[model samples]
Structure formats: C-alpha cells, structure tokens
Target: MEFMMFCRMLVEISFYYSFAGAAAAHFGGGETVLPALLLSVCYILCELLEKHVTAPSAERLQKAGRGESGGAGRFFRYLGLLPAVFWLLLPGMAPADRICFLFPFAYLAAVIWRKDFTLSRYRQTDVFSTFWKAYGIFALTLTIFGGSALLETTVPAALVTVAGSVLLLRALRHGSEVWRHRDYQLRSLFETGLLIAAAWALSRDAVLELLKTVAAAVWNRLLVPVLTVVIVAFSVVFTWLFQLLRYLLTLGHREPQDIGEILQYFTGQGEALTETVVVSDDGSPVWQIVFFVIGILALVILAAVFFRWLLMRAPGEEHAAEQVEKIDHMPPPEDRKAGGIFRNTPAHRIREHYRSYLRCFERQGGTRLPSDTSRELARKTLELAKGTQEGEETLNMHLGRMREIYLRARYRQEVREEDPAEMKRQTSAVKKFLRSRPG
Candidate 1:
C-alpha cells in the first residue's frame, strides 16, 4: 500500500522532470495547466507549512531536550492563515478560486484533529470552532449568496459556481464517509487522479490563469518545510555536541570539586597564576583578554551542554518519552479507556457525550431530555459540552445516510443492523456546531 502511494506520488512528481510534452501534448496541456498549477501550489504550501512551523517548534522540543519519542506532531497544525495568506497574495485568483485554495487546509486540519494526531481535542472547542466558522461562512457564501438571483445573472459563471457549490455541500455533509474507507490510501490516489482529470476539463484561458496563480501559491508553501529541516538539523547537531561534552567530563572525575577544579584550569589562561590580586577596583571587568575569552567560551559551552544534556535532556528526551509511551503502549486503540492522566484522546469520549443527546425520542414529563442545542440548559451539567441543535436537518445530515436506514430508524420499525461507526464524526460535527452557539 505504501509502495503504491510512493509510485503514484513519483509518477505525479516525475511528470515535472520528464521530457513529457508527449503526455501533455496528447492530453491537451493547455486545459489542465491552471488547475495543475493551483493544486501544485496548494501541495507545496502544505508541505512547506509543516516543515517551517514544525521546525522551530521542533527546535524548541529539542532544546527542551524532548527526544524523538514525543515528536512535535499534528499533521495539519498551521491550517488557518497559511492557505488564506497564499490566496490573498495572488492578485489574479478570483474569490471562487480562493475557496478552492482555502478549503483543503481547513479540511486537512479537521481530519488531523479528528484522528487525535496532536493533543486530544476534547477541550479544544476553540480550535475546532474558529476554523469551521470560517469554513461555515465560506460555505454559506458559496451556497446561499452564490445561489442568489442577482449572482445567477452571470449565466456561465453562475452555472459553474452553482454546480461547485452543490457538490461542496454534499461533500462536506458526507465528508466522513469519503474519508473513511478500507482502501483509503488507494482512494486518495484515485481522488488525485480524478482531480488531475478535472483539471484537464477546464478551458484554455482558465487553465493558464490557474497555473500562474498555483505556481505562486506552491512557492509560498515551500518556505515552511525548508525551514523545518534546517532547524531539526541544527538541534540535532547541538544535541550531539552536548552529549559529547558530557561524555568527556564524566570520563574520570569522581566528584563535583574535581570536575570544577579541572573546568576552571581548562577555562583559565595559563598566565598570572599568582594571587597578587589583579587590582580589583570594586569589580569592574578588567579584560584579561585570554582569560576572558576562555571564560566566556567555557560558560557558553557549559551552559549549552547543561541545557542540552542536564535540564533539557531529562525532559526533552526521557520525560516527554515516558508520557507519550504510556499512551502508545496501551493495549490497543480500542482497548483504551476514556480517562488517564497522560492519555489525551478525549475526541471519542467527547463524541460519545454529544451522542447521548440523540437518545431522547421525545421526552414525556418533567424528567424530559434537554434540547440538544440548549446552551444555557446544557451549561448546568456540561459547561462546555453542548452540541449543535439536533434539529431534524442536522440529524438527517449526520446519522441518516441510507434511505432504507432512515425509513426503518425514523418510524421505530424493528431494525437489526451493525452499530453505526460515525459516533466520532458526529462528535466532531457537534463540536463544530456548538462552537457556533455562544458559551
């Protein structure tokens, strides 16, 4: 499976280096160029953002001396502004084109958060809400405003925009279905092929414009990753140096005094071993040039080594490792429980909390179930745990997928099907939905 992805990516990349006007000439290069450019720019930006943001954070990780074990992670961490910034800088990109650019970053960020890639995102309502509100506004504009009578006056663009708008809505509503597949790797490859094919379906003029915009966009994304590799390389070198010094210092010395005397001798200049008191005028720094250089170098080197090996090494390497290890070393992803000090995956539990809202088949008495969207009421038990309104529309979008399942489940007809797997997806939607509601 990995090999397949590798081969597919290689093929996609190779078209660049190949004397491949042959392929382009046949398929009509003029058509696909713009989308190819747009996708290429997005692709580059994604990689670069990961590299750059992760690099400095990774350096901090290493300096804190966090080891490779608890790696600085979160697949789509810098999802918010990077893509938007890329789109804004491209003067030629239309608002519609900008949507295409922004959508993927937002989508990827949600997906990563969903997968529990970084911190368990339960209390992370702020992160989830901010990104989706932007997305929801974009969606609202595309679907509602784009479909308005005045906008529809532009016939061809209206037609294209309307089609894209409808598909985006459908795609988002059933997004988890698309993301969750047994052969997800294969599916992603297939989707890329389809996108590339769609690129070919464009008009020549549109293609050229997209290509230029995409080129600029791709360049923007490249900056981040390039920075990441540089930072990692530097931190690793520093670690190596610090570790080496520790080895040398500890090789023979038995006590702190022994090491300290040796360190002073090694750091001090050979000249002026006499105790004649070098005329201290109440301690203004008289530059004993050789000693000063030696002292400064020793202090810098010692501090660096101490930080890398002592204070930082313990936490950066051993400490962070133990914390992550407890979670990863759990019996299985399924066997793990909801609560543990170091076990941070509350995304599932948060989902379950929200799903309990759905069990109320219309309450009867004073003990009736609370309205799912009632923020004030929900605040009594769950301060921040409220979900989006379980209005028929939201439920229909989330829990109802198949026509048969909807009919059977809706009418209370006896039904025996496997339990739904979308509790997590529902939870994420609830998080996104409630975020729209106030405290």
Candidate 2:
C-alpha cells in the first residue's frame, strides 16, 4: 500500500511538471519537453532518496538519541528550503522570481518555528501546496518581459488564472473543511471568476499578437474584427483548458531553465521579420492535434482505472467490516502476506517472527545490542525471564527451544531428528504468549 501511494505521487508529480512546462512555453515562451522530463526525473529520484534512505537513517538516529534534536530536524530544514535557495541563487533570476522563491522558504521557516520546529506539521498536502505556489511565482515572473508586454500578452492573465485554479483546487481537495466555513464555495467561485475575467482581457491582446504572427493575411477591415473575436475566444478556451488540465494532472499532488529560447519566443530575440510575417492557416490544426493527444491520454487513464477495478476483487463484507473494527490488530507478517507468486520462504517467515519475538523481549526489559547475535538475544531475553511467573517461565522455555530450531533451520540446512509436530506446537505457543502481553 505504501509503495502504491508513492507510485501515485510519482505519476502526479510527473504530470504536474509536464503541465507547468507547457504553460511556461505558452505564456513565457520556453521549450516544454526536455526540461519538464528532467525535472520530473529529479523530483522522483529525490522523493525516493528521501523516503528510503534519509528518512530511515533519521529514524534510527532518533531511536538511538534522547532528544528532539536528531537527524530528522536537519533533514527537514535542508530538504524544505534547499530548492528555494538554489532557485534564488541561479544566475539571471528576476527579482520577482527571487521573491517568489524566498517568500515560501520564509513562510515555511516561520511555520516550523511557530510549531516549535516540529517537522510533522508539514504533511504531503503542504508540500503540494508549496510546489503550486512556487509555480505561480514562476508563472507571474513573466513581468520580466516588460510592463507593456505583461499588459499586452496573456502572461498576467495566466498568472491570475493559475492563482484562481490553485485556490479553487485547494478548496476542492479539502471540501469537507471548506464545508465547515460558510460561503467558502461562493467566495472561491467569485474570486476565480474575477481572475478569469482579468485573464480574458489580456487574452484579447494575446490573440491580437498571435493573429499578427500566424495569420497576417486575415488582417482586413471587415475580417480583422471577426478574426480578433475568434482568436480571443480561442485563447480564453485554451487558457481554461490548460488550467483544467493542470488541476486534473495534479489533482492529488502538485522548473526554470531555457530562458534564452523563451526570451526569443516572446521578445523576438533572434527571429527574422519574415518568420512573424508569414501568414498560414496552420495554427488551428496543430492545436487540434495537441488536444487530440491529450484526449487520448485521458481515455487511457480511464481505461487503466477501469481495468484496475475489474482486476481487484472486493473483500467480503464481513471480513472488511471486521478489519475496520479491529484496525489496530496487525496480524503477523505471514498472516497478512500477499497472495502473489514467489511468497516468502518458510525460513524467511521464521526469521520475521524471530525478530518480532526479540522486539517483545526488548519491551520486557531485555537489552539486545546491535552487535548481539539472534541466539545471544534469545539467551539474554530468557535470562531476563528468570524468577518470573510460571506462565512466563513456560513461554520462555518454548521460546528457547524455538530459537534453537530456528538457528538450525537457518544455518545447518538439515532436517532435525526432533518431531515436526513438537516444533510447530512450541512455535505457536510462543507467538500466542507474545500477542497476549500488554506491551
């Protein structure tokens, strides 16, 4: 289940990067392909490292230490703000861009300080929220194009639309919480509409620029008005579509390189005059192809979901309800083992239960050091049980015998002359006693 959740987050982050890349291309004049792919790969790798390596190491440090000042604090501080610092320190980052990155880092620090530096306050949702906000900063940094360009192009409008979508999605994602606040939906809708309306105004100017660049032949007294209206309508529709796409792609979760190409696309930095002057009816068809591919991708997702549902069998109601009622009852690893092929071997299962019983011994005041062997731990645990209750004495005797059998099974690789029935009985008795203990 944890692996599945991680995979889902991975997919969502990939889509989010893809969407952000596309938006950057359309509004800020950048290449969407390679940078998006690179960022997605980096994000997934970082997440994998953080979860599997860094987090576990920090947890071990916490276990061996006595205070809140463990590796976890240092990990959170660096993990949360390092990217922001990297972005801000990058050469040629606009002041607004630096501010964008800086604001989030500052806010996170403040929140952490307010919470007494407890990293647990920031959940996965908070991470997603911060990423989206950083995207907004990048989106809004289009003002670097020039104040006039910002007003005349779709950049400002795109910023507003992105902001609205972020807020609206946040509300949707926390619908139950929003429901507790009266007029939350109304306020969100009203704010979103106002931003979109602002976007529509800038979109008209953007359409004019797109028209001048793409279909200059359509520039006549009669058709100019009609073409402008049509292009403006198209821009609005496309903006909304892209916004919806971003929201959907990152519905569960939610980069800047190649500024030179973006600058060229926006400021005509290296373009010949003829390139902008050439009028062709090629725009709509290319857009259609793009939309077609997106539609196909959506259909594939739906099919995947459908097939997944078909393949997964629903648990029986009685078993499902019992599972819910006894949520705290974590059965042994073998009992909850997966039904797939290549199940863990009997030796592996025995090792798991052996470790579990060792943990039980530690809880009962037995000290098992890191250098202690399995046999050593078992012997030390039995020593701790000396002069205890009769029930504990019997349980420890069974545990000692089981440990010897496990040692032989693990190391000797030969069947013992002892009865298999007695071995099974002793193993079961030890497990039953461990589960019955309060700790």
* C-alpha RMSD of each candidate structure in angstroms: 28.5, 28.6
Maximum-TM-score candidate: 2
For model 1, residues 1-439, the per-residue Cα lDDT tens digits are 2222222222222222111221232222211234323434444444444445644576677788775324335444445335445644777554433433333334333322332211111212222222234334533564564433221112222222223233322332333445355676466556555544543443344654676589777767886678888999999999899667767767757443565687688667444445444755555366566666785465446334322221111112223323321212111222322332323323333334444543321221113345533333333223333343545356445433322332333343322313233444554454454444444
lDDT of each: 0.37, 0.45
lDDT of 2 by residue, 1-439 (tens): 1222222222232333323333333434322222222222333344444455554665676798843445554354335344545554778744433332332234334322232111111122223444456445644565565433432332333344345435533443442454346586566546544644543443354655665666556556668899899999999999899767666656545412233456568767446665767666766888988997896466446434422321222223334323321211111223332343223334444555666667666666667788998667756755565554457668668977887767765665333324244566676665555455543
lDDT of 2 at 178: 46
Regions of model 2 farther than 4 Å from truth: 1-50, 53-55, 61-73, 93-101, 108-148, 152-439
Off by over 4 Å in 1: 1-44, 47-87, 91-184, 199-439
In TM-score terms, candidate 1 sits at 0.23
Please, what is the TM-score per model?
Answer: 0.23, 0.24
Q: What's model 1's lDDT at 9?
A: 22
